[model samples]
Target: MDSPTNSQKTVSDDEEIDYSIKPELYDSDLDDKDEQWMAKKRDGRTSDAVLSCPACFTTVCYECQRHEQYVTQYRAVFVVNCEVDKDRVFQPNAIPSKVGKRTRDSEKQETGSADNERLNPVFCATCSTEIGVVDIEEIYHFFNVIPSEP
Candidate 1:
């Protein structure tokens, strides 16, 4: 009859009902990008966070500039592009995932719901910055940055 409150439950409200001990479920201030977000340093702290392509220095992901290595996980892990949800800013590669069925199946199971999906390299449209790897559907982006680079 009306815009149901927490009383009249639905699929969308599974989060509100599940009382699991998932810390993320409780903390409302977590960003999904913290895992793969790194910062370009200037004065010990990440003062220059313009995460451009290391090969060409072309700006690809402008959002990376806003991410800080001090606060976030800063591990540079692979994440579902859906988790990033900043598709407009990212640039998916023209090529497609060339791996075999085994890898594809594994990737799908890892991320889930990416049926018939494949991954591709997300290089800098302008420079040599390989931001990460993403699926053809832009569903998953694998980006694991080491501590230092050439």
Candidate 2:
């Protein structure tokens, strides 16, 4: 049998696909972490290594931190160990959603220390997604930063 001649033009011969509307779809600068994050996102999942808001993909904390655990069901209970960590993880406008006063007794019962402090729920400033709760010690307890199993 005789072979057929090639008719189709290759991508290199044609104009590049217009990804201007969604440039991120064709972003060539995506690093390994970003690629992993994108893959996880496509699979309807998330990663603890990159603490970003699942709704808006706003990074709350980056990797390479020595914090206790960025990924956990305890709502990042020990993630922000101190003010420095808090400053690193949360932005300045990342304030509490609401304030609720907790008695020292109840606080002690829950955290094993008696210190009167107001507990507040932290929400994403961009999407207003309920990220987590700030406990008496100013530690974040994320409820659904990413829809991941812990």
Predicted model with the maximum lDDT: 2
| Residue lDDT tens for model 1, 15-132 | 6665656655455544434323443322233322333445654433323322354532122322212133234344445547566645566766775663345445555555434556
TM-score quality measure for candidate 1: 0.28
* Model 1: CA > 4 A from native: 1-49, 65-117, 127-130, 136-150
For 44-97, candidate 2 gives per-residue lDDT tens digits of 533355466768777554322223654344334333212222332332255453
Among all candidates shown, the one with the greatest TM-score: 2
Task: Provide the TM-score for each candidate, comma-separated.
Answer: 0.28, 0.38
* Alpha-carbon shift of residue 136 in model 1 (angstroms): 5.0
The root-mean-square deviation over C-alpha atoms between each candidate and the true structure, in angstroms, is 20.1, 13.1
Candidate 2 has a TM-score of 0.38
